[model samples]
Target: MRKSAALALAACVAVPAFARTDVGVSIGINEPGAYGRIDIGNFQPEVVYAQPVIIERSRYYENRTPVYLYVPVEQQQHWRRYCHVYRACGEPVYFVQEQWVEQRWREEHPGWRRHHRGWDRWDHDRGEHRGYGY
Candidate 1:
């Protein structure tokens, strides 16, 4: 009976390790008091990180949502200008880097290379449709 109990305990521990899901979000730093900054983009945008960028994730509906930390003041101003020009504010935005998107895309769509340039196909198509009433 002791052997059976031990076996069951071992299985309980081992199963969860393999049953975990990958939500496609990761943190590069583990600093205390790190907080997610407000993001204003369709997807994660490419930027030069002068400081360590922190992202937070929460389970939303059936998918996980990521929030990106704010960039430096200068970078924020530049991005704000672009947002105003493109009318991309007041939309649901998640902070993600370009590389992270590419990696996730490659995993989902195997055999397809990352050829969409900086923005993904959705952003590209959105830009095209923005000229119309969208």
Candidate 2:
């Protein structure tokens, strides 16, 4: 009984120590600037469409970065289709709510220089994406 108990205890500690110390390390080192699924180069659209459901802009980082997209209620389907094209590439797509637009605006224009009262409020009422300058 004592021998069996000691053996079990030893395994509990030893097994984990040698389990997978190098499991998640090799992939990251081999493919620099790559996460589990995200492709840094493919994070943003290569060519901006004349009109799109959302204008997605992402800044690449070691970890996942928030995607700045503008998708309204009616344009949701269009956005889904755009995502489908990239699905085969194994890229993960994330959608930030409408608030992201405002957040982006604030980040770009810090401390308020005036002459921009309605700049933050986007008119999503228009079903078509203006592809407006961001």
Candidate 3:
């Protein structure tokens, strides 16, 4: 009975370890939840703050122009702590308004649909995929 209980507990733990699935989604510029430098292009972006936020001041970036970014609200507020994530610690950053980013993404990818390819093809095999209009 003790061996069976121990085996059952081991099986329970091992099952979850093997069943773990990691899904990596790369969010590009203008996409929802994307945090990085954004291409300003010809469109004027509404900024979150009027003044650019500079976490780390460096002489190297003095001549370089301030780049616009679309970062999370929390990251924008605590830029000093999160600037390294975007590799803009030594440069000036202007956080664009989230609403504007979403609007631009929708405009550009009017018919965008999430594509389940590669490892995500399991959904297609399981018949869980709703046709994405090809």
lDDT of 3 by residue, 1-134 (tens): 99999999999989988863543422346466656888665455789888878876877776978878888888888899998888888888888888887877877788765462448654656765587864
1-134: candidate 1 lDDT, tens digit per residue = 99999999999999988864644444342221232343334444454454322222224423524335433344444654443433334333333444544454466567665353567756665656565676
For each candidate in the order shown, give its overall lDDT on alpha carbons.
Answer: 0.45, 0.41, 0.76
TM-score (all chains, Cα) for each model: 0.28, 0.25, 0.57
lDDT of 2 by residue, 4-104 (tens): 99999999999988886444421111121111222223233221233323234345332544332333434345655555443421223443334434443
Residue 127 shift from truth in candidate 2, angstroms: 28
Worst 10 residues of 3 by lDDT: 20-29
In order, how many clashes per candidate? 2, 0, 0
TM-score pick, better of 1 and 3: 3
TM-score of model number 3: 0.57
| TM-score of structure candidate 1 | 0.28
